[model samples]
Target: MSDNASFPHGPRWFAQPGTARTWRCASAPRQVRDFHAALTGYSPTPLTELPSLATELRIGRVFVKDESCRLGLPAFKALGASWAVHRALAERAANGERRGRVTLVTATDGNHGRAVARMAHLLGQGAHVFVPRGVHRQAVAAIAAERAEVTEVPGNYDDAVRLAAEAAAGPDAVLVQDTAWPGYERIPGWIVEGYSTLCAEIDEQLAAAGVAEGPDLVSIPVGVGSLAQAVVTHYRSRPSGHAPALLSVEPDAAACVLRSLVLGRPVTVETGETTMAGLNCGTPSSIAWPYLRGGLDAAVAVRDADSARAAGDLAALGVASGPCGAASLAGLRAALSGPDAGERRTALGLGPSSVAVLLSTEGTAANPRTVTDE
Candidate 1:
């Protein structure tokens, strides 16, 4: 409420109470952390406190989980990519499939492709990455830098995902997609499980910082909702039965989750170009929808200009952030201000003493910049 007047057509807020049940993880939190630890250059990403920003926002504290560098990649996608690949490979081995070099296949707007390629390179396997036409060329090059074959498809990300699924049907190929359809859920589920490592780390970091249960609110950037599902599941399933008020942020042009939440079912939207390239997804993952639909406290769609400003704000605080990453801040500003903000805040149980965690999903300029009409 401090700087609401300066906000442009801001921070649309939509929220409903969560009604979903919890799930049991396939592997325990310690096991997932151990798996990540076994990887090269594995360590917990930084959870930075921004007291100045917290003061500006008039909150107890604002903590950011920096994922700029995860396992040599410049994004958190490596966690999901590596763990999914490992599980996929292990399943093949268990089924008595011949041991041979296998190619990893996936579609990405950017980061996920490079991550899968990195894992493939490490495993002495091949990688073929498919990208939508709107994806930045630098992103394609980064994926290619891992020696993965890069293919530019005809339409949006969903179209590229279709082609990737087809290519992965080859006997020597394994599809490691992050989003899910009907029969394509198992791999994506493992990806979500992999992302549990992030929330698990957040718990440890918050405990180390002396926040016993957790922050009152956690703002997460949503693409296809896998990571958001992971966050929702992690907090809701806590042994102490304490969960944070989960908020999801997305690009206005592709707010599938927000739209789906409003309609009480999954729905797809036509996506357009935006600077938040990593989150330019048109559809929500079907498997993730159930968890998200029942667990999210709020969902917000932000403009490119708003996200850019938030990124700059983070930069001034020495937190390098891209549009997708900084979107958490943009969404937070709207959720705590704008229309019905006071009522919404009360419903979410947020107050001056409430702490908030912003999940910064990427580093600065992870994708090429795009022009947008402010």
Candidate 2:
């Protein structure tokens, strides 16, 4: 059933060859990582070793890139937002434009918008954030707390993106969307580039832990697939040719990336409400599609209960994570213990000695949304 039945409500897993593809980097990965390092209050987020969880999962080791806080934001979105905003402003300045202040506009389910607003606040610029209906009021208030203008669209996340795009017209505003379509790829690509810092930091942390080798697998949570794209591109493009098996996790109600990969081309879906609010995307990013198709080893969707349980499990282990952030754990469990798990594990070369890394992309306070599956 790898290629069949990719509905939004079903839990599914699909694997692919994940051939490597060439991409012309807008900026070198080192350059992007160093740029974040030079930022004020810049510090490498923790790569926590979860030996207890690893033992429970029957793996050699498990390391989670704990992204609860980065540059004063509660999610890894700040990495992309800061870099994309900086690139956009630098591009405008290169064009010799003398605008008093440029407003950054973007749409978000929650974390991305708040991160963008934080960047705009830092640069003393304006931010106009568009959120779809059903995003928690707390998330909206967080954006407003950054002194940004928050607008609620009446439809889904994609609709908010549309409104944000429309509002970003003219020289005084720049659309810093994380998803890319035709004629709007630059800023999104910059955002993808910005996410390389996470992978770079993981490498440094792993080396420090005396595990200088790459993990057998990495589970990444997908929201429009930009961060997963960054991870795939980073690993596949490595000179050492040590790209691990990359698995993307998403909510069952919003498994756009999973459904798209199942179809072999990007396809929009009827996204429903999910506890992983940050991942409630209906469509995959066009710019990220190629890299994901060519470099992602697999994609899976998990239920709200699973995400909540995963969040609780991580919290019990002293790792602070939200449902959206803990979706990686949920999906990793599904991939390794669900139907045909033995086949999947054997296929991925996973065993008792397999090492795995999960990207915990947010903290609990990042998106205070309730998760009661009705």
Candidate 3:
């Protein structure tokens, strides 16, 4: 196989006749409203300006979308996966699937698994989550607290995903997977829609603050590209006359999205070599591919060192972040340093007048063993 080969793995085994149809799904305004309502108990995560970091980089402005407080989940995955599973359960109930007990299943490196477990527990259903072998102990414990059964697969994230899909297909289980391929499209799309709330809130907050246009650039991390797709979708659909350029970042070893976008298809790469464990994805989700292919403006792959440094920088600035969450800032930092980065900045008309946003997608507590490097 080529180093950049794209892998297609999913429920093609049991896919119905229409399973291979183009998987294009979007969040309805009403469903989005319902999702927001259900999640009201979650504190409105703060969007704070990183004045100190901005000054040091001489970037016009920088803002951090702090997701640490999301439903006490400490990760932004709570918004997407949990809300998606909730919506899925409601839909199943509408279809009479809830007359009997329904279970949701998925595989994760960590946070998405926890979100699925929490949603299952809250909705009176059971969940069986498959996790990668090297997943952190704390993350596993957190998922277990949601009362979900956790099984460790003997491979990487992609391997766990394969196993989950296999199990969910057997019998009456509902697989609320974040990555879509053949038969599964609706649930993953719902997950992406749930994440749209974050960007919508950012736009409203910035507008209310008297910033007419949106940020000059927005950076987000990629793990199967769901969150990145959500941000891109929201900006593309934003009513604002102007939208910021979207940049997606990933760890060097798991830059599958970058490779996929370049080749115009989903690709798989190596795993287990990056410290940004949350972004240690091998392939981009089929559900998220079209959004990244057309909606996002750029993609960057940064070294583990840069991501680690960003986590440290965030911690120093009173914003706690793990390596995966800090990958976006590392992309921003690289975009500021390279020669073409200057041109990209100029093309975006960014100067001291421009404002930028970086998404801190997880709390440092997710990886207690990962210390921020000085």
Candidate 4:
């Protein structure tokens, strides 16, 4: 079967989704290479094929882009967020600014903050990460491990964003926020550019396995949609015949992408409850909207029950994923087995021979199984 046949909108659908013409990021190959070079000492994450899961699902093949093993940091967010901070420092240094005096600021529920903190420590800069009240203790611990000062504020993810923005409004503090509003574009784009590394590695791994055609679908989790945008952008830049159908997964409580897809425009929904803290972003980011609206093929919002269940499943399977980490697999598992599975698969032109990949972004955060019980 033709690769594009499974996807109703075809492989170039991302092009029409309104992303190609929007504020394009510096996502060129050279930038990707430079970003990779900046972290030359770090080890590359693995792309492990899950033959057992594929057999159970009755699919031809399935691969998990495992980012849990990245530098002991659990998530792929570190790749992008850290790269953005480093690049921002590079930008400052290029302009003759004192790099050591620069401080990076960002709002996070967890992973991104740790990434920023990690970068700050490596580059001789300071970082301050803001998190919503009731943020996960383990997440805060992770960021603190990188020597960053962490602050918690009242409200949800949105409130933390506002607090961070206020702090970043000063001189010598660069806002490295993942969610972009107006007049602040570079960091978010750089985050996406950092994400290109994941896709680029996937390309190499797939080729090594002798898989010539692209996956039938690529499923990813969305918070502010930075990683999703990056994946879609990277895939779109490739030859049309090689790109896969892109699907985004989110916590049901924070179904911003579903709302956006349904409304045909961006909309923020109140995320009242979810165990998938990392995926609990209530609103779509302004910078992420263009790419999301243009490149995303479908979205599935999984409930907290499924997220926790997927987390447990990964643990049983010895994969070690957190609630937020296993969210994409939860959504994909539902999409492949629930009421919409068959139709969705057919509509997207997937079949038994089609290969699909899902990214497991982080390991169990604070889960006793993930860390040796102290």
- TM agreement with the true structure for every prediction: 0.92, 0.93, 0.87, 0.88
Instruction: For candidate 2, write residues 1-374 as lDDT tens digits.
Output: 34244454443888875343233223335689889989998899889999988887788999998888778777899899989988889888899998678889999988899889888988989999999988888788888888999988889999999999999997789999999998999999999999999988888888898778778899999989999989887777766645578889988888888778777889888888887889999999999998888888788888899999999989888788988899999999988885588877765668898789999998876333312110
* Model 4 C-alpha lDDT per residue in residues 136-179, reported as the tens digit of each score: 77678778778888888779999999899899887789889888
Regions of model 2 farther than 4 Å from truth: 1-11, 18-28, 366-374
For candidate 1, lDDT tens digit of each residue in 187-305? 99888888888988898999999897788899999999999988887877655556678889998878888878877889888888888989999899998898788778888888899
Q: Weakest 10 consecutive residues, lDDT, candidate 4?
A: 6-15
In angstroms, give how far residue 291 of model 3 lies from its true place.
1.1
Give the C-alpha lDDT of model 4.
0.74
Better by TM-score, candidate 3 or 2: 2
User: For model 3, how does the per-residue alpha-carbon lDDT over 41-80 read when each residue is reduced to its tens digit?
Assistant: 6556778887887886676778898876677677877778
Question: What is the lDDT of every predicted structure here?
Answer: 0.83, 0.84, 0.75, 0.74
Question: Residue 253 deviation, candidate 2, in Å?
Answer: 0.7
Q: What does each candidate score in C-alpha RMSD? A: 4.7, 3.7, 7.3, 5.6
Supply the TM-score for candidate 2.
0.93
Q: Which residue segments of model 4 deviate by more than 4 Å?
A: 1-27, 37-40, 366-374
Q: How many steric clashes does model 3 contain?
A: 1
Q: Is candidate 1 or candidate 2 better by TM-score?
A: 2
Sort all candidates by lDDT, best to worst: 2, 1, 3, 4
lDDT of 1: 0.83
Kindly provide the TM-score of model 3 when superposed on the true structure, using C-alpha atoms.
0.87
